[model samples]
Target chain A: MKLLEDRIRQDGTIKPGNVLKVDQFLNHQCDVALFDQMGAEWATIFACKPIDKILTIEASGIGIACCVARHFGDVPVVFAKKSQSINLDGDQYVSKIYSYTKQREFPVIVSKRFLTAGEHVLLIDDFLANGKAMNGLIEICKEAGVVIEGIGIAIEKGFQEGGRELRAAGYDVQSLAIVKSMDPDQGTIEFA
Target chain B: MKLLEDRIRQDGTIKPGNVLKVDQFLNHQCDVALFDQMGAEWATIFACKPIDKILTIEASGIGIACCVARHFGDVPVVFAKKSQSINLDGDQYVSKIYSYTKQREFPVIVSKRFLTAGEHVLLIDDFLANGKAMNGLIEICKEAGVVIEGIGIAIEKGFQEGGRELRAAGYDVQSLAIVKSMDPDQGTIEFA
Candidate 1:
């Protein structure tokens, strides 16, 4: 987590309204090496759980999920589709996710076949803000009758309630870096 | 490549309207082991080229790009955003792509900072159908003044004109599996 926090401080940009721009490495442009480290760290934490598949919501989450899946003995990764595609069957477990970054509510979908009943699932994502997306994925997992083993995230907005609420609910959630606060005036990021 | 072809023959489904669904392994439900094989194969093919970054389109392409980047000494993977996001800055190289899967046109955006001039870029994608997405990515690389060293595809629709056009234009394009045709009525897939 120290490496991720340092990377954020070095390359992350803070704008008005607590906007953290990490496109240089985290989102738009990805650092696969860093993701590998983050994945290794998550694997170490979730080593006790039975993770049959790693679930994440696209498009940013795919990179981290793939890297993490590698460390888990090449476990299958199932990404919840955000956009409507012809390839996806209509009979899917759908959940609504409100994107704080985009400020819109959209449906994230996963086929019923991909997630089997009673399978242990590990959820991963790039960022956790309001936890809407995480909740949506959890709902989908529940509908599929899968057991939620744990949740892994690269960055968590500690100031937000998503991480706190999940922890309060007794879900094992691990975040590599938690941003406590960001100040545009001071051009600084505070970590929890 | 043989492993991927075998996976398609075993798990791929043929739907109506020339659609071949391999969601069981590729795209939606990703097999990290198979993806590692593909990454190794691509690394063998594009070994001579100096690839500084792996460029791919969002959603499905992100996973393969991430996997492939690891073989290339953990090169940066830059994915083109299909839709506009608050995380993306105003300074971007944009291109319009016609989607054969959805039968629509959409914009692909890449931050200008990620791609630098004269850098060697390897374009990676899950499938090459009509080649609209590949074309858009190529255009973005051109606009950014980056040299596209080669292209790596998981599957290529050989019946379509996309691969033919790109090859005629002298791009070193490599496809793991090339589907010659698909018969929905017979539930058969022919590969070239």
Candidate 2:
């Protein structure tokens, strides 16, 4: 976690609208080495839980989730698809998620065949903002009657209610780097 | 490569219209361990080239790209974004690609900062059908003035023209598993 925070401090840019531009290393242009480290950290924290599958949203979260799956003894990773595709057919557990970054609501879905009843699922993502995506994933898991083991995130905006709301709901949520505050004018970031 | 071919033969479903449903282990639900094997194989194959970075498209390619990056000494992996978002700003290299599976064309964009001139990039993807995505990625790299060392694909539809076109164009293309043919009724698959 310290390594992640340090890397964020060194390379992350603070922008208006409380956005942290970490595309240099975290999302667009990824640092797989850092992802492996974060994966190890998540595996250590969630070692006690029974994680049958790692769930995530498409695009950004897939990289970190894949690395985390490696640390979890090569557990299978299931990513929820944000857009409906021809390849995705059959019964699916669908939920609507509001993307604060994209500033819109879209449907995220996982095939029913991928998730089943009584399975212990660990949800992973790149960032936690308003907790809308997490809630959507949780909703799908609940619909499938699967047990929510925990949620692991690469970065979390501490000023946002997503992390706080999950913690208040008694979910074991862990974030590698939590941004406490950001000052765009000063180009400064405070981590929690 | 044998491991991947075997896994595909075992779990891969043969649907009509030449659709190989490998979502169980390749795309939707991913096997990181197998991906590491594929990565090791790719690294061994592309070891002769000077690869400074691993480039890929978002969603499915990110997982294998991350694993492949690890095998390449933790090289940075940059995934081109399929959709535009707030986080993506500044100069970008964009290309339009037609999806054979999704049955539509979309734009793939990469930040100019991540890819620069004189860098050797290796493109990685889960599947190579018509090669539209690969072509799109190659176009982006060309626009950035980056040298494409080669292209790596997990599964190449040999019946399709994509692989043939790339090889004809003098690009070093390596596919771990190339499906020569598939019979839906008999549930049979042939690999090239």
Candidate 3:
């Protein structure tokens, strides 16, 4: 995770309210090369676990999930859509999530056919803050009767309790870079 | 393309209202191996063009775009987000798009910083039907004054006017698999 930490320190922007923007290469504008490294790291970390599928939320998580899926021997990546679409009919495992970034609550849904019973699932995402999205995905996995193998994240806000809570709960959670602290006025970031 | 066509014929579900669900591999539950082939195909097709970046819409398009970017020598992949967030605060190029699948309209926004003038961009998407999403992406590129090399689509509804219109308008649009027609009752699909 040294590369990711360095990239964050170099390219990440600090703003008020604990915002660390790495849009240049992490989220909005993606760097596939960096993602490849992150994916390789995730694969190496979870090499022992049995991962049948990679689950993620829509928007930001898709790219990282796709990259990680390749590393996991091209496991199928199923992303939960933020809104229900006509195509996604039939039984679904839905969970409501509050987005601190957008400041809204939305239902994240996955077709029941995708995540079936007894499958080993690894949840992946771009950022982890309050862990609302991660919890929602975990809820969906539980409802589908899938075995939660682990969680992979590109960046984790160390100031937040999401990572700590998941670790305390005995989940195998791995984050590439963790921002321990940030100062908006000085534009400084400390890594954990 | 033959592989993709075969995948559709074998795994794709035909529903009423012209819905051909290939979510098992193409979108929701993505096949990174197939996407790698797609990325190679697009790279071969547009090898002559000077593409500085790969542009796409969020959610479904990000995975395909990331794969395509890898084939294009790991060019930056910039995705237009469907909603506004706290991180996206500066000058943005916004376009409204009507979603036939979701049956609603949403605004797609790209920060002006990621896409700049004089850069060559290629738009990639999972599906092209009414061309609203593609057009919205094109509008965002134009607003940023980026030169569009072309548009790459994994599946295009040939029965729909989107592909025809774009081709007629002299845009270099390439669709890997084009569904000429579909019958829900008979469970038949014809490719163009």
User: Model 1 chain A, poorest ten-residue lDDT window?
Assistant: A82-91
- In DockQ, how does model 1 score against the reference complex? 0.86
List the lowest-lDDT window of 10 residues for candidate 3 chain B.
Answer: B135-144
Q: Write the per-residue lDDT of candidate 2 for residues B92-184, one digit (tens) a residue.
A: 999999887777888999999999899999999999998999999999998999999999999999999999999999999999999999999
The lDDT for every candidate, in the order shown, is 0.91, 0.93, 0.93
Give me the iRMSD of candidate 3, please: 0.8
TM-scores of chain B alone in all candidate structures, in the order given: 0.97, 0.98, 0.98
Runs with alpha carbons beyond 4 Å of true place in candidate 3: none
After best superposition, candidate 2 residue A169: deviation in angstroms? 1.0
Name the candidate that leads on DockQ: 3
Query: Candidate 2: which pairs clash?
Result: none
Of the true interface contacts, each candidate retains a share of 0.89, 0.89, 0.93
Encode model 1's per-residue lDDT on B70-180: one tens digit a residue.
999999999998888777777899999988676688899998989999999999999998899999999999899999999999999999999999999999999999999
lDDT of 3: 0.93
- Please give, for residues A62-153, the per-residue lDDT of candidate 1 as tens digits: 99899889889899999999867889875899999888777788899999999999999999998888799999999999899999999998
| lDDT string, candidate 2, A1-192, tens digits | 899999999999988999999999999999998999999999899989989999999889999999889888888999999988778888999999988777788899899999989999999999998899999999999899999999999899999999999999999999998999999999999998
Pairs of residues at least 3 apart in sequence or in different chains that clash in candidate 1: none
